[model samples]
Target: MEIIRWQDDNIVLLNGAEKRPMGKCEAQAVSTLLVIKERMGEDSQLTLLGCAVGATAAFTGFHRATVSRHGPDVLQRPEKQKTMKEMGKKERARHIASKLTMPQRAFLVKEIHNIWADKKYVRVESLWEWAKANISYKYKKTYFFWTLKGLGFVFRKLNNMTVVEERPDIAKLRVAYLKKKKDMDESNAFYGAFDETWVHDGMAPTSGWQHANTTMYKKARMVDIESAQSGPAKGKQRGKRGIVLAILTEDGVLPGSEEILVDDDDENNQKADYHGVMDSNKFKEYMSRCIPEFSRLAASKGRPGVFIIDNAPYHNATREKPPTQTSKKADIQQWLKNNGVSYEAKAKKPELMGTLKNFLTRNGGRQAFTVYEFDEWADEVEGVKILRLPPYHCYWNPIEFLWAQMKATIRGMGSVTDSLPIVRDRALDTLRKFSPSQAAALFRHTRQSEDDVRGMLEERESVEEDTSFELLYEVDEEGVMRNVHISDDDSSEYVDFSDISDFDSTQ
Candidate 1:
C-alpha cells in the first residue's frame, strides 16, 4: 500500500488509485509494520516504500516523536507486555507491605483485636484515629484501613452475646415488623416516632477543646439550704432531671408536642430512676394530646401516618389483660366468651387452651389475645396507625436518633452551672432548631438500618435452611473469626505483620 494519507480529517490508506479509510488499529498496525521494514534494510523485498514516522503520526493523530519512540515497542509480544504488568503489580504490593515495621504492624493488629474484644462493633475511621494518636501513623486513612485488611482484619459485623437478637421469637417479630414497615413505605405513608428521654443538669458534652495548661473538669453544686431546720436538710443534693416527651415526624417535631416534666424540689418525691417519673398514665395523656395534631399533619400530606414507639413496659400496658394458662378455667371461658368465641364451660384448662389457640390462630394469632391500650387509642384516631418497634430493636425508631441529636446539642450548650430550667430551655431550643431536612435525613438513616437488619435476618434464615453448607469458622475470645486449622496453630500469631514496614513511626 502507498503511504497512509489524512483526508478530510480521516486517516485513509492509498494504494494506486483506490483509497480506503483506516481505523485506529489499522493505522497502528501499518505504522508498526513500516517501523519493522525500516529496521530490516533497503534490500528487503518486503519494504514496499517505507512509511515515514511524520506521515504515520499525522494519520494516527499522535505526535511524530511519540510514533518514532513507541512504534517499535508496539511490536513487542503480548505475553511479554502482560508479564511486565504482572511484575509491576507485585512490586507495588511489596512496596505497600514495606511501609510499616513488623512490630508496628503487630501493635496495630493487637489494638484492633483488643477493641473488638471489648466492643461489639468498631468503625475503620475509629481505628484509623486510634492509630494516628497512638502510633503517629501519618499515612492516608484509606491506606491505613487497607493495611488492616491485609493483616486479615475484615470490617464485618461481629457476632456478640446478644442472645435476645438471635432468639427465634425475636427474629419472627423483626420479620413481621419489617413486613409492616415495607408495606407502609410502599404506600408512601407518613412516619412519626415519639419516645421519652431524660436530661439532667449534670449532663455535659463528652468532648471539647481545652487550654493546654488548664484542665477542665465538670463540676456541679447542690441547691443551697438556709438551715438544718428547713425541712430536714437535703441528702447529697443532686441536680434536677427532666422527663421530656416529644413527637418527631419527617417535617421535624410537631408543633406544641414537646412536654417536659422537671423533677420536684421536694426530697421525698425524687426517684432513683427516670422511669419512675413517667408512667403509663402520663404517657397515655401525652399521646392523647399530640396524636390528633399528628393525624392532621398526615392528612395534609395526603398519606396515612405511622406512629412508631418502642415496646417500653408502659407503652405496652393492656386495656384488657389476656388470661394465661395459670388463670382459672372460669376466667379463660369468660375471656373466650367476651371475644365472641364459644367454648365448653366444664372443659379442662388444656382443652380450653386448645380451643383458644384455634380461635386465635384464625384471628391474628397469639398477638390477638391482648390489646395494647396505645393501639386502641391509635385506632380511634382517623389517619394515624401505631407501630411498636420489635423487642431489642430500638434503632429502627428515627426518634431515637432525634433524641440523640437533641441531647448532644443540649450538652454542647450546657455547663456545670446549668440548672434544670436552663437545660430544659436549651432542649426546647434545640428542638426548635431541628429542621425538616434534618428529620428527613434521620428517617432515611432509619430506613437504611431497617434494610440492613432485614437483609441480616434473611441471610440467617437461608443459612439455617441450607444444612449442607456449614460456615467453617469460629469466633475467638477477641471476636475475630478463624478457620479451625488456623485456630489450632497456637505457635502462629493471630496476624502476620512482618510484611508491614515502620515508615510511619520514623516520620
Candidate 2:
C-alpha cells in the first residue's frame, strides 16, 4: 500500500504501518496515492485516507470527501468521550451542591417549612428574594425549582380549608352529623339544608366557545310576548338581579320552600313581593315559617326532620358580651344581670337578672358566661333540629352545589329580561324539574366527603380540612417558622346614577 503524507501531498509506499521516522519528498512519482494523516499527540486519533492516481489535483476530491465524513469523531478519541459521558452527571451535581452554602441550605429549608405551616403559596421570587438577602446570591428560578424538586417539593393549589376559626373538636362533630343525616334508622327521618343567594338580571356570565370576533353574553334577554313570537334574537335590557332563599334535601327542595321574589332595585318595589336581601330578621322570620312547614313535610313522610343552615354572621341571634378593658366593672356586671345571663354569682350577692355584682369585683365578669337565647328558641321548634356546617366548610352542605346547578340551568335558557323573572320564576321552574334521584347524586358526593374527611383525620393527614380557601404548593423544609407576609392595598369606587338620563325608547 502506498502511504502519502497528507499536509504536503508527498507519497511513500509503506512496507507496513508508519512509525515515528519521516523523510521529505522532492522529486516524487506517484503511482496510486493513499493520503493518510499523521498522529500528532499521544491521544490524537484523527487519520485521513484516500486513493488517487498521479497528481495532487487528481486526489483532491477523494481526500476532501474522506475527511469531511469522519474528521471530528476520529480526532476526539472515543475512550475519552466515554469517560466524560460517565462523569458528567456527578460533576453537575457537585457544582449545584457547591452553589448552596450550609447557612443558605438551612435558610431555604426553614423558609419552605414556614410556607407550609401557614398554608401559603411559595413563589420562586420569594425564594430568590430570600436567597438574595441571606444566601448572598440568587439562582435562576428553573435551577432553584429543580433543586427544590430534588428536595421533595411540589407545586399545588388550595382546594380546601384548614383554618382554626372554630375549635377542632367542634368541627369534628360534622362527621357524626353527616353519618346520621344521610342514613337514618328511623323510618321517616327528614333532612334539609337551607341557604340564600342573589341572582342578577341578563344572561348569566360564563366562559364558553364563542366566535372570536363576537362579544360575550353581555347582551339582553327578550321577555315581551310579541317579541318572543317574533324570535329569540329580538330582545331588550334585562333585570338579572334578585335574592333567593332555598332549602334542599336528599329528596330535593323541600315542599314548604318557595321562591321569594326579591326586588333588586327597590325594596318597596310593588311589582315584587319579597323585599331586598336576606337579613338577620328575615332569616329568623324564614326559620319561623319553615319550622311548621318542615314539621308538616316530616308528618307527610312520617319522619322526624333535621334542618341544616350555614353559620352566617346574620344567623347569630345572640353573641358573647364579654366585658372589655374599657368597660366599667359594675356596668358589665349589671348588664349581664339585666339580660338574665347566667354567671357565677356569690351566694351573698342578690341576682339582679342572674349575675353577682361582686363577680365584676374580680378581674372581669365571668368569661364563661354564654347567651344563646336563639339556639334555645330553635331547639324549641317541634320535630326539627337546626345544625350549622363547620365554619369555612360549606362543601359539607350539598345545597351549595345544588345552587350551582340552579344557576347553570338559568344560564341555559335563552336571553331573559325583566319580563320573565329568572330568579323567582325561571330558576325555580328549573329546580322543580330536577328529579329526586338526580339531586340525591349531589348528596351522595357530600356523604362521600364525610368519609374522606374522616379518613384524613384518622390518618392524621392534615390539621384542618378543606373548608373553602385555596391551597397552594407545600414545602417540607424544617426549623423556620415565619410564614409569607401579605400587604393588601384596598380601594372603593361608586358611580353616580343620578347624572345619567333615562332611556328614550322612542329615539
Write down the worst ten-residue block by lDDT for model 1.
Answer: 227-236
Error of 2 at 50 (Å): 48
Supply the global lDDT for candidate 2: 0.53
Candidate 2 C-alpha lDDT tens digits along 1-507:
223333344444332234234434422333323212323332222322432222222434434444334343222224432231243543333334344554455567677667867867788878766766776654455556545553345566655445632454445445545555546523445777787765556654344444453322222223343321222343323454566777887677876575664555642332332334666787778877776777677667777767777677677666555555466657666766675656665522344323343444332233224344445575675647666565677877878888888777766664544334544577777667767887778767776666655554554455464331122223224312122211121012121223223311121
Model 1 TM-score, all chains together: 0.59
- Tens-place lDDT per residue, model 1, 1-507, is 334543343335654336567778877976776665556665434433334455556556767666555544332223432221243533333334445565555566667556755754567888888888887678766567656644445546654546555576666677788999989999999999988887777566556654343312211112333322212112223467788888899999999988799766554666665667788888888888889999999999999989998877778888777677898988889888888987776788999988987786666556546678788778775557888887777777888888888887877666767777888888888887789999998888888767765665556577644222122233454433443221222223232333345324333
Clashing pairs in 1: 99-501, 100-500, 100-501, 100-502, 101-501, 101-502
Output the number of the TM-score-best candidate: 1
